[model samples]
Target: MIVGIDISKKWFDAAWQVDGQGRHQRFEYTDEDIGQLLAQTPEAAHYVMEATGTYHARLALRLHESGRRVSVVNPLVIKRFSQMQLSRVKSDRADAELIRRYGEQQPLSPWAPATDEVLELQQAHGWLNDLIGERTRLLNRREAHAHHAKPNAFVISQMAAQLQQLDGQIKTCERHLEVMVKKSFTELFERLLTIPSIGAKTAIELIIVTDGFRRFEDVKALCAYIGVSPTTFRSGSSVNGKGGIAKLGQGRMRQLLYLCSWTAKTCNPACRALYARLKALGKPPKVINVAIAHKLLRQAFAVATTNAPFSTEYA
Candidate 1:
């Protein structure tokens, strides 16, 4: 039996069907109901669920404990598929049924959770990003206040203290993240870091988001996966504008690359020359930034694929 679980914060809906059977069963969302359903039919082949925030993890854990094969599908992919035939209606029960039928008919890829250590790395990266963003905000506020009127002594002092705390936390997080990356993904880490603008955080992010670079065939595919590939917008007899990136893949990876692009094109001579050439040819600064990010992304992919440090010569 293959079953699809549509999970929510409070409840879960189940759609189940057997391989050679004509009838299918749909169960309304409920807790403790899985145990009963499994008891009635214990020969489960695989149980699939759509990835919803923390909502689906607990149920997945329970199902796994009962020796059921469980997989989570990316919700974005599911949503796209769901819109094809139905194109309009959406409901918990209907979604569950859709997932079940799709699982049976579409030969969709199954989702596997990352290993514990990788999950830890991702969590650490998320925390570090949060701290960095908060610190930036605090610093911006401090700058604006100090430049404005004569700032109140107490308020300025408090802001300074908070900024210092955030700074300390950010450093600590980076240190721990570096240690973890070196410990877990050593050779790949060392090789990739040689590339300009690449760091422990960015490297770890690519690893986690790519699931150790397993999915894509090569570096260029990885570039597309990273979402730096330029997309086109066209009309009847006109190419209107080439806007920002697709923003389709790993968001953290995209954001990290954007930050790297700004520095990479400044500090790395090869990339800086590319930026200057683009600008002199009348390409916008933002366009140059995107192009630089694209190069860095492809270079990172090359480093991973060839097990070599990124080389400027490309020879």
Candidate 2:
């Protein structure tokens, strides 16, 4: 029985028994509720739900423990899909139905959580990033006030001290995560470390972004998945080769890649040559920057996929 689940905190709605033989049935999300539902279900392959607000995770884990195949779709993909439905309506039932069709209509894969260390790194990294963003925003506002508002009234010195403290903490957290990564993935970390520009932080960030390198099938697909592929678009009779970074994948991954690009431009001969060649061909600085980022991802992907150190010989 294929199932589409609309997950919430206490209760969940399910588009039931998607054998295409019946309509839909809703159920509560509890041990008893799930146990009873499982009793009635004729063993199925896939159970699909959206990755809804960290709530779906527990239920999915429980379901998996009980020998059921459960998968969580990203909300963005599911919502974008909902727009295409001819009779699109906003309701729990509608959501469940969309999930049902998403399961039924497409070959959706199961959800798998990253390992504890990767999860820890992601949590720490995201928190530090948020803190940094908040600090930047506060600093920027204070500076703007000092320049444009009552200049004497706005004070920025104390906040600058706080910013320095936050920066130190963020760096400490990053170093700990990097150490954890080195312990967890010894071989991969060693290989990535050989690349002068691919540092511990960048490699660990890649692990989180790759979900421990599980989803990608190969390097080209990895590049596309990271949204580093230069896309193409056509309008009416005109074609433009101007589509840049897809900006659709993990932001953290893209950030690491950008940093890698900057580092490689200095430390990597191939990357330096490529960047120069593109500049010579009249590419915009931003375009060349993005291309450099893409190249770094490809190198990182190659290292991860092959479990080998990056070779300058590839250049």
Which sections of candidate 1 miss by over 4 Å? 18-37, 40-44, 61-69, 86-90, 136-158, 238-243, 266-281, 312-315
Question: Would you give me the overall lDDT of model 2?
Answer: 0.77
lDDT of each: 0.76, 0.77
Candidate 1: global Cα-lDDT? 0.76
Name model 2 segments beyond 4 Å from true: 18-29, 151-158, 239-241
For residues 24-80, write the lDDT of model 1, one tens digit per residue.
444434546767657655565677778897788767776777777787888886888
Q: Give one clash count per candidate, in the order shown.
A: 1, 0
